[model samples]
Target chain A: MANLTTKIGNLTLKNPVITASGTFGYGEEYLDFLDINQLGGICVKGTTLHRREGNPYPRMAETPSGMLNAVGLQNKGVDYFINTIYPRLKVFETAFIVNVSGSTLEDYIETAEKINSLSSIPAIELNISCPNVKQGGMAFGVDKDMAAEVVKEVRKVYHKTLIVKLSPNVTDIISIAEAVEHEGADAVSLINTLLGMAIDAETQKPLLSTITGGLSGPCVKPIALRMVWQVAHAVKIPVVGMGGISNARDAIEFFLAGATAIEVGTANFIDPAVSLQVIQGIDDYLQRHHCESIIDIIGALKTA
Target chain B: MKKFIGNLVVSENIPLKNNHFLLKLTQAEPLPLMLPGQFVQLKIDDTPSVFLRRTFSINYVDRLKNEIWLLIQVVGDGTRSLSKNKTGDSLNLIYPLGNSFSMPTATQSRLLLIGGGVGVAPLLFLGAILAEKGFSPSFLIGARNVDGLIELEEFQKFGNVYVTTEDGSAGEIGFVTNHSILKNTFDKIYTCGPTPMMQAVTQFAENKSIDSEVSLENKMACGIGACLCCVTQTHQGNQCVCTDGPVFNTKELVWQI
Candidate 1:
């Protein structure tokens, strides 16, 4: 009987378990395995104003307990999504949030404006924190000023809920979160993959073609939790927390740390049904604690 | 189209030359239709260090028996652990994943299938399917030595089989590209194996202006396309090897060769 409903600005998610962008492709790849309607929200792959070919061969490398990737936001541009992908996704009952990315401010505005025109897409997660791309990705996220500028311009064209994704590579994640909040961001999501690299000892060469790639998985949980706790305290808007969250227990930690909703990223690669399992686990935990609603536990951390 | 995660009982484990083992797995449910060049991701439950599932090309599929065969080479931690499995032991698999090899057109009758080492796994399935369609495809396989060669008898049942070994103990003394079989005019060629050997085959096919396809084996995490780890550069752009293809026409690939 516990209520899993949560709100981020004007948007109300059925549950707090949203599939992270890039991890879930337009929500079609997993349809055969599980029902897409069960998810609270599906954040489609990162899309740009123009088509992107992505990085070269060996785009990913497996680490100790994680993986590094430099896919560089590969997609067929926003036009194709609107014309082809949007129709297939419009029938889904769950919220469809577009993860918009660009190398320039105009690209962000154009893409966001296009997404705003699509009635089916309820929101857009502005990806200023993608570490794979060479130009605009982490560059805009690492600096508070660039992050604010992109959000401010996109805010003009994008009428839907605007969630700015924060980068962990920054020295002060709170500053970037506050900047986005000030620029009219409805919510903020953190932390996009930590920038890391791996080397093959035998060959003495970098494992990935893009020498340094974004590291994600269970290895990044602790760091992601700490940043979410800090940013959630600094900003008044809802905070969508994610990083190496594999199970429900991991997600509960994020809720307790003050995250309104949670996104499951790398775990999707490990188990496609992980998000559904997490949703079921949350319900079980709330019942076990005799809690009536998820809000009762959100940011309910006990610190001495 | 259906993906299953079930514990398959190992009905037979035949040890082959060069640390290779042919594992025959049987399940209670009916086996799904698996095509040539499609692979299965086997979860390594026994080993702790290897967390990711190991992928193997389907060597054979027997629908009536509800069984399938996996040709595994004990090269890494995952494969080495799989080799230790017994007949009664159970292993989990997510199967019938990735794109399959394209069947040759009716006009393209003369066909050649090439494989190097364990890369020969998918070729057996491809050869069998082609044979069933009334085409006898020639197979040219390469290995390091006589012991390195495997599954010759199963391959012979489909078509003319030729072998090349680094040591001169096999049918031909050099690499598959150097084998006498290459001199024959084949309308279509399919190859999978070491990168160098595949590239060589691709080059030879290009020289003769014949249609050719090559299967690539990239390191993969999810057998599905969710993880973009196993992407290969093609003439069109970068495509997921797990979803877009494990098999692609040589013309589609942008290899340096």
Candidate 2:
């Protein structure tokens, strides 16, 4: 078997395929379909400092090759996970990276401090890029200084690996990526859902309750690749790329674009075991190419 | 862990009343244990516009035959495409998702099941279950007109079947709430259908102070609890309809009666 190991900052993944936050729902949801430990890592749901009711019903709408979700980080708070959810998750050998999101700087810091104590958790994906929320999510991520500030504050209290998730809705994604890297972010995950909308033609009303939602699936793949490529070339920290990665072929495109690893987002909704197929598919590609390891293809995009 | 994703071959596709079709599926392996009001997330092939898997309530489960039945109404592209499935064509499914309807309490003997239009899908399964349990359930199914009323013979096999139509072309007319059957005292009520019809049933149950439950059909993406898309506000907070319930105690709902 060709070596599939890849690193994102200090965190080492058995493979380069990770299930995206909000899509995988703690790793327990897919137990019926595949072994959770087979994954490189699983980013749990986007959790907040306090319980959020999230948005109302009608939070999603289907579009061509994609879907829109305004499910604004509805979780039972970080303490609930650490107390009730974390114990169950501890049995899984795969990395369980909690996706941390907050409405304020203190919320982020407090949430990270609590998670920092959990030994099973290896990293925290600072969700500064969730576009569905009204505050603190995409707000801090779109601005370079605000992105740096949040990562800087969380970095102080969070004693483990901190991966800053970046928003693709921003005009200059590279600047935001570089800013977080300068502020002690160990690695960065790029292309959180691009903001989009859908309308019911007959009803002539917005399909989603929030009117606008983050777009994911195959439609956003090109834009995600562009941003990952731009950010990877700009920042020294390892880039964890994601957005519309449904299969291993899509994943290979990201690796060539300098993404050290890729996250499978909306694809999980279609097939719960898709991440495992991606893992197997990646291995098949490496062996077919006679490549010794996945690292050989990272940032190896042929410009000539 | 009991739920799974697998491909079940289409054994037969029998067209029903109108745009509706009874899709009977079978596999070499036994079908998973599905409940009366549970559902499946079916993956649509050849329809790219229908990006997400479409959710449908379990119409019936033929455990002895290792077959499952999904009563589909051609509402849009996703369902229409599914209706076109031929025998031997395989369909990917995530089965037995969401919670099922609750069984009757010891003191509760009288049973009422109200379903509307295609919403009557799951009640047939529930009616069969109730009959099997010796509950002798009564069904109050409604539709826009006579043609809209579906699966009467199937429901009849389980228990007494009653129906209402707006045009009065069928049984005792007006909405299902206006049917004379509601006048009878019932120990328990179960309903699934269009929101307005289910709401009417809920209003009746609440007014009588009788115990009742209604299955919700909120739009869903992930049939598992993962996607927060399908949620219903309850007294406890907003709970996911996919896992928390496709079936919920009418008492728990925050809806105004």
Candidate 3:
């Protein structure tokens, strides 16, 4: 039987299919549909130092074959997650990666420090690249210096696998990925939602209350794959790819493009059972190809 | 984890002229404990091109007869397809999702139920719960016009019902807050509907220093709250409405934010 197990950085996952942050609130929400312990890892919702109230109403707008959202890193701060959610998540057998976000440098360090001390957490995905918010979200991610500086500061506090999540809203995503890697990000995941907008022709107004929102789902797969491939070639660290990955074939594409692990984001909106489907698909593909393990396809793409 | 739980077909698909439909599903299983203000995500395969499930609040549930009712507004392609479902066609459903309205306390003597637009379904269910517990509530329901008002003959058995239509063809012509019944003090207030309408009720309750709980209407994914798709701003911080609430106390909400 083909083995689906894979390792990204210091963490060993049963498979490379990890649920992206914001998409999977925590692992427990999908427990009824599937075993949370069965998959690779669960990246919890973005947590901040102080709880943020998020943005105004009409936070989400549906685009053709995709969705745009401005959820604004809305989370119950790090302390609340550690207090109310972490203990419950400890029961899941898979690795738990905490996705942390903050408006300031100190907030990032403090939140990272808090999660670093937790025994249940295996890694931290610093979400400095969220495109849906007006505050510190894409602000730190768009700039190479700010992105590296944020990663550098968190690197001091977080001893676990530091996976820097990169935003796709920049001019050149590879430069940002290199900057974070230069500052010591063990791994990187791209691309968080892409910046998008929708308009209500009748009202002559923007569909989302935020005017602009982060687009996800099938609409972002091509762009995300391109960035993943670019960053993988540019950086020495492991690259975890995500963006519009709804099916196993999508995951395989990322694997070929050079992502060590894959994350399912907006597809969660399509099917809560999607992650399981992707896992099975990978297994089937591997078996049919006579591959013993997933490592064979990690970066098999040939260069011209 | 999904079994062919049950298939519900369209029994009655009546359009309320308010862009909403009062759909009665015929084929359903024995419902588990469903509370007021809870919802069901429906799989309406009326047409082959349609994809994704449309969510509607459980307007009422008849557990004994094994029937479920939904008050759905034909807003998008999904709902348009649902409206076309014939009586014999089947529909897949995952239901009684999100947090229900807080049940009235035993010592509480009065229950005030507020509803706006399609948000009245759960309130009717709430009224049924109050009736079962022998607590009669005063219900204030709102809509844009007479076309928006849903027939409430069945609800009369559960509570005192009042209707507010923007066009004045019904019980009260003005807004729900303009009704005399809501002007008085009550032990508890429950509401669901348009955000602006709920915000108004919450503001009114705040002025009187009365306790009220509002059910939010936000886009959701995994209706169980995992998607973080249905998030709301609260006094504490950003919280998933699907998890932390679909029901929240009025006073506790940081509405201005």
Instruction: Give the number of the best model, judged by lDDT.
Output: 2
TM-score head-to-head 2 vs 3, winner: 2
What order do you get sorting by TM-score, best first?
2, 1, 3
- Candidate 3, residues A1-304, lDDT tens digits: the string is 5788877778889899999998877877776667777889989889999886677767877776678888788777888999998888888798899888888889899999999999989899999888776678789999999999999999988898999999999999989999998899999999899889999999999978789989888878999999999999999999999988989999999999999999998777556777989999999998888889999998888777
For every candidate, how close is chain A to the native chain A in TM-score?
A: 0.99, 0.99, 0.98
Candidate 2, residues B121-219, lDDT tens digits: the string is 999999999999988999998988999989999999988999899999999779999999988999999999999887888888989999999999998
Q: Give the winner by DockQ.
A: 2
lDDT of 2 by residue, A1-304 (tens): 9999998777898988899999989988778889999999999999999999999878998889999999999999999999999999999889889999999999999999999999999999999999988888999999999999999999999988899999998878888999999999999998899899999889999999999999999999999999999988998899999989999999999999999999999999999999999999999999999999999999999999
- Greater DockQ among 2 and 3 belongs to 2
Report lDDT (CA) for all predictions.
0.90, 0.92, 0.82
Candidate 2 at residue B22, lDDT? 94
TM-score of chain B of 2: 0.98
True contacts kept of each: 0.38, 0.86, 0.33
Residues B1-257 of candidate 1: C-alpha lDDT, one tens digit per residue = 77766679998888887899999999877788889999998877756566567889999887767889999999878888898889888998888898899998878999999999999999999999999999999999899999888999999999999999999998889899999988889999999999999999999999999999999999887768876778888878888999988998989888934
Compute the interface RMSD for each candidate structure. 1.7, 0.8, 3.7
Candidate 1 Cα lDDT to native: 0.90
Check candidate 3 and list the clashing pairs. Answer: none
Could you tell me which 10 consecutive residues in candidate 2 chain A have the lowest summed lDDT?
A7-16
Q: Please compute the TM-score of chain B alone for each predicted structure, in the order given.
A: 0.97, 0.98, 0.89
Model 2 reproduced share of reference interface contacts: 0.86
